[model samples]
Target: MLWNKKEKNKPKNISLKLYSFNEEIIFNGLLTNFPIKEELILEKTIEHFEDYDPCFFHRSVVSRWMYFEIEEYLNKIDEENKSEIKWQELPENIKKILLSDKVINRVIVEKI
Candidate 1:
């Protein structure tokens, strides 16, 4: 089945990890608190993977957050729409935050 019978009513909790040059920072919370622009990505991933009782897909979630955050920063700079922005065009501070080793590195979703 697309959805696991036992996981149908479980609460989804998300764990995020950020890795730096010398340290790793972890954040834990409900999946609802995560920022996902496309709900279909999560739903489809769950449907296709039967063993994903506790889904371990960090890159997708973090990449989404990164895109949104950068878009927000872009919007603040001007009123026109910026559908395609290049990394080199971003301001130094914005680039610094994105390039920082401390940014999110992993995401885990557990059904509890």
Candidate 2:
């Protein structure tokens, strides 16, 4: 797809980490808050939170936080067996984002 200057600036990936605090918090920061969800996603082209909170970096946003290859990470979310995350359980920020469906024209298993 050909993205122009304006469109390219939009956040292509929404970063999140699992088990941030202590243990067993899969899809960690994915369900966390970021001040105000509407303000952030709207104002900024790309939102990043690698160190703001602690968690396993499941989605590789950039080279600096590259735990897994981008292709592999994207593919992982496509699989059918991806964990199911309840909508009510999601934090306000994440819930709004996912529900808005700003992701893109792709097949990403956005359960958890």
Which of the numbered candidates is closest to the native, going by highest lDDT? 1
Q: Residue by residue across 1-112, what tens digits does model 2's lDDT show?
A: 1112454433333344433223443343322221223343333324464343323332223322221222234334445354433444444544434443232222223323
Model 1's alpha-carbon lDDT is: 0.41
- For candidate 2, the per-residue lDDT at 25 reads 36
lDDT of 1 by residue, 1-112 (tens): 1123465443223233333334454334433443443444444455555434425574355444444444345444434432233445557644543453244443222323
> Each candidate: what lDDT?
0.41, 0.34
Taking all chains together, each candidate's TM-score versus the true structure is: 0.27, 0.23
Worst 10 residues of 2 by lDDT: 101-110
Largest TM-score belongs to which candidate?
1
lDDT (0-100) at residue 72 of candidate 2?
A: 36
Model 1 alpha-carbon drift over 4 Å, by segment: 1-56, 80-93, 97-112
